[model samples]
Target: MGCASYVKRDEYDATIAELRANDARHDQRLDQIQATLEKRFADYDARFAQFEGRLHVETTAHFAYGKAEVREADKPMLADFAKTLAAHHEGVLVTVEGFTDPAGSASYNKRLGQRRADAVRDFLVSQGLDADQVRTVSYGEADNRQIRPGAWGDDGLANRRVALVIDFVEAVAAR
Candidate 1:
């Protein structure tokens, strides 16, 4: 007769219980990570507004007045945004629209705005987004688009911003 080995019933139960505990720990950790990411995204003041036409998603992030460089604090949020764009959204055009706080001449502000937009677009591209899929536009102290017109310096921070628009060409319904 060949010798046979068997696991006791208690031993089997303990093994299964251990596996369940490990799985639960993993689940809880995942939940914690998710909450952290959500909070970080919100803290950066990211807003999304969907348009009825071709504009699918609009997320705006404020920038420092008269500065074209992307802030270091904004990187994590931007990376997350870029990841979402790369993972879920495809065949969509990403437009980064730059605005100014009316701190200078209209022409100068326009160029500053374009630099801001280009900086953001470059960052997005660095985060794995396609360069061709992204474009930049400068509104540059447009009165209509300003959050607080004639408000520059500390008060005009809100007006200085870059808005990213995801244009869904294929998703548009037939006219």
Candidate 2:
């Protein structure tokens, strides 16, 4: 009976050793997978940064003082911008940011900015851009470039413009 108990103890010890070896192997494999995933994500981040660096806001659509209408002269420029966006940024989201000079009450300027953004959005949609891909936001006097003590006239006109911004989309599974 003593010999039989010794044999059973040895068998149990061997089984535990095998399980420890298997666990170690699994841990090594998980480490390798994590390293590979980390490298891939680093590469993805670098590529995204490069793409973002190349993107610039298109600010060709300038507006007159207190007006939200798209001028006849600026229509062609807007058309070109829409075509470029539609061609290059398919499936990407676009934001039309509207700005205004500090010439009126804050609320009025905000509403005017929104109207200008909407006008630009409508024109872009009319020029073959998907409406769902476009959105509008009013910065109003918040981002007014002409708010300096000595700034006036053309500065205000420059401030009253619509800028087209592109938003990058990433795959949900990656996150």
Candidate 3:
């Protein structure tokens, strides 16, 4: 009877030991799964952040609209506008794109557009903006305003203006 009792006690002890080992293995696997889930969520968050940054640039803020008809009278406003541009688009490159309405001859409009772009570039330089940071292009009437045949008027005034565009080759971290 004493030997039988000893054998029963040993069996009980071994059963408890086996249960403890199983519980430890289960806890370890649970920890590993939790760690993997955290890593995956972090990766997904990073990808969405990059995608949102590109969307912000594309959706908001038009870097266009210089001034009306590059006239001597527009000179003062040109300086003011340069400061505005510098303040708004400080680190980004600025391009002076000029366009014209469809009324003028194609060749004349082309030359006019070039002149308009040049005028804007000069104004920006005079206002302490770096000349190297600014570029100029002329589209003339190639990308003219679209309006109904007779309904077109000075409504196209906005179209006959220079535009500044900022670009990014890759997703940049915000400062």
TM-score of each: 0.69, 0.61, 0.45
lDDT of 2 by residue, 1-175 (tens): 3554345888999989986785565445334433543343442211111132123354546788889999887787677667756764455456788878877887998999899999999999999899988889998878424434333356667677777655533311122
Per-residue lDDT tens digits for candidate 3, residues 1-175, read: 3554345888999989986785565445334433543343342211111122121111111112333345654555446545644554444345676666656677876777777778778877889677876677777767433222222135555446555443222212222
Model 1, 8-64: lDDT tens digits are 999999999986785565445334433544455675666544443333233456688
When sorted by TM-score, best at the front, the candidate numbers are 1, 2, 3
Off by over 4 Å in 1: 1-43, 54-60, 169-175
RMSD of 3: 22.2
lDDT, candidate 3, residue 28? 51
lDDT by candidate, in order shown: 0.74, 0.66, 0.50
**Model 2 clash pairs?**
none
Query: Considering summed lDDT, which 10 consecutive residues are worst modelled in model 3?
Result: 53-62
Better of 1 and 3 by lDDT: 1
Q: How far out, in Å, is residue 138 in model 2?
A: 0.2
**Lowest-lDDT window of 10 residues in candidate 2?**
45-54
